[model samples]
Target: MSGIYIHIPFCKQACHYCDFHFSTNLKKKEEMVLALAKEIEMRKSEFQDEIVQTIYFGGGTPSILQIADLRFLIDEVYLNYKVVENPEITVEANPDDLTENRIIELSKNKVNRLSIGIQSFFEDDLKMMNRAHNVEEAKKCLEIATQYFDNISIDLIYGVPEMSNEKWLQDIETALSFDVPHISSYALTVEPKTALHSFIQKGIIPQPDDEVAQEHFHILVDKLSENGFIHYELSNFGKENYFSKNNSSYWLGKKYIGIGPSAHSYDGKNRGWNVSNNSLYIKSIQENKLPIEIEILTKTDRYNEYIMTGLRTIWGVSLERIEQEFGKTYLDYLNQQAAKFIEDHLLFVDDNILRTTKKGKFLSDGIASDLFLLNLE
Candidate 1:
């Protein structure tokens, strides 16, 4: 089964650490919605033979749209695609946008899941990140949302400058208090061109400490595990059957269609992404032309992706699958490159599946990169 992702590229305000494609000016909200519908129809044939199992609304801020606007987009998907009975429909929402009435409205629209962007529960942390919602809004929204939705996930940030271990633990505890089934936590990274990056460059803010971040990662893994949450992915924890189907489909290299500006699509062999600009995306779709760039994956490219994503999840890379799909040469190369990590106890092969040990989980990306076949053609 395939999945569909809709990227809403507008935000109420910019977060200091965010680098995602978005516009604070929302004059074209209605126009953008129509354009998204048009694009969805235009790309329906891309996945005509596949049943859509998941529909995700991710963005700048999907919750900023009015319920009617959201319904319009959801209806468009139904009109153009053959969806599964009771497909997993999710929308990423900010605490500020999810009022009591809004939560009820979303439930009626077949939105089975809510991925709330409650980055922090502390007022100081919220202000530090320039979050649009306050501490009260964060708690109130969850209290109200829980009454209406059971499949909810909340995001939390760790390793922010000056955020002590105590505060981080408090954040985790606060989230647990909600008793949500899934949690997606990430470390604060200073990406180039983001306000946080500039502030660090100018000494206005201290750079993120890798050692502290590593410490926080361990704390997160341990706390979540103790609470009976499976560390299903490097940055995700979920109870049984509560894992994100949309995201899991992507990680497992399943086919998906991504609609809207800056969205990406993959169909087993090729990957494509739309232009990041809003006006350009709308204009191009209006002209019946897709504003996307596509690339066909080579054997090495696909192998490297399998290595990276597989190492990050609970299901580790399969040595047998490697030999079956990529042949003995690629399998031998993977074995050769993985030997050092295995020797260091960072990675281990159990029952022919190469998985990262707890010690190597946080550094899985780096470890995966080292095993890549850079010069393979």
Candidate 2:
């Protein structure tokens, strides 16, 4: 089954550590929504025979849209695309935008899941991230949202500068108190060109310590595991039957259509991304042309991707699939490259499935990179 990802590229305010494509301007919001709907309609044939199982509204802030705007887009998908009867439609919302009424409205309009950007429950942490919500609003929204939605996920940030281990644990505890099914926690990263990066460069804010972040990650894994949550991915924790279908589809390399500015789409062979500019995206779509760049995946490229994504999830890379699909040469190359890591206890082959050991989980990306085949022609 395929999925659809709609990127809403507008935010109420910019977060300090965010580098995602978005605009603080709302003037083009209406035009952007229309463009998004058109893009969905235009790309219908891309997934003509496939049934859509998930529709994700991710963004600068999807909750910034009015109910009518959201309904319009959802209805557009239903009308033009082949979707399942009960597709998992998720909307990524900020705590500040999820009012009591808003939660109810979203439920009525086919949005079965809510991924709230709580970030942190502490006021100082919120301010440090320049989040739009305060401590009370974060807690209040979850209190209200949990009443209306069962399949809810909240994002939390750990390893902020000056945020002690005690505070991080408190954040985890507060999130657990909500009884939500899923939690997507990430370390506070200092992306280049972001306000946080600038602050660190100017010595106004301290840089994030890798040791501190690693410590927080372990704490998160231990706490979530103790509370009946599965550490399904490096950054995601979910209860049984509560994993994010949309993101899971993506990690499994299922084909998906991404609509709107700066969105990425993939078929089995080609990957494409929309232009990052809002006005340009709208203008191009209005002209019946897609504002996207495309890349055709080579066999080596696909194998590398499989290794990268597979290593990060609970389902580790399959050696049989590798040999079958990528041929014996690629499989041998993988085994050869991974031999050292396996011997070091960073990775292991169990039942022909290559997976990272607990000691290698945090460094899975680096290990996966080391196994990549370069310049395969």
lDDT of each: 0.95, 0.93
Off by over 4 Å in 2: none
lDDT per residue as tens, model 2, 303-374: 999999999989999999999998999989999999999999999999999999888888899999999999
Q: Which stretches of candidate 1 lie over 4 Å from their true place?
A: none
- Give TM-scores for every candidate, taking all chains together and pairing residue i with residue i: 0.99, 0.99
lDDT of 2: 0.93
Worst 10 residues of 2 by lDDT: 101-110
Error of 2 at 355 (Å): 0.6
Candidates' RMSD to native: 0.7, 0.8
lDDT for model 1: 0.95
